[model samples]
Target: MDTCYLCGGLLELLGTLGRLAHYRCIDCGMEHSAGIDNDPTPTKERTDNDTDMENQGTSDSNHD
Candidate 1:
């Protein structure tokens, strides 16, 4: 049985259309299409303003 590579839960077999099959992560709501490589997480681009969270220790967005 195929499981979600991301969430590690049982993958739901949507249906086979022609030569393609689809699957979805029940936990994370990530979708996988048959003919495409599955990227589980959103990729963040490095920016000049980007810094280590441990070093910065805070965000500009206020908690209040």
Candidate 2:
């Protein structure tokens, strides 16, 4: 499970700011954007987590 760098708390996807997804620590309220790593594959797509959330009809915009 991905954790917050500051508090080691479980992170939750808040929303996307531009092309990057932002996450927040549920425990400490620490917020940060998701990191994009360089993949050798030639696919340009969002993370699976983001895709899954979208498929489930949940999005950052829906939170508000």
Candidate with top lDDT is 2
Q: Rate the local accuracy (lDDT) of all candidates.
A: 0.58, 0.62
TM-score winner:
2
lDDT of 1 by residue, 1-64 (tens): 4666667876666666676667676776566556334433222444556756445866587767
Residue-level lDDT tens digits of model 2 in 1-64: 4677777788777775566676767887766665454211111346799878778954457534
Cα distance off (Å), candidate 2, residue 57: 42
Candidate 2 RMSD to the correct structure: 14.3
Tell me each candidate's RMSD, in Å, in order. Answer: 11.3, 14.3
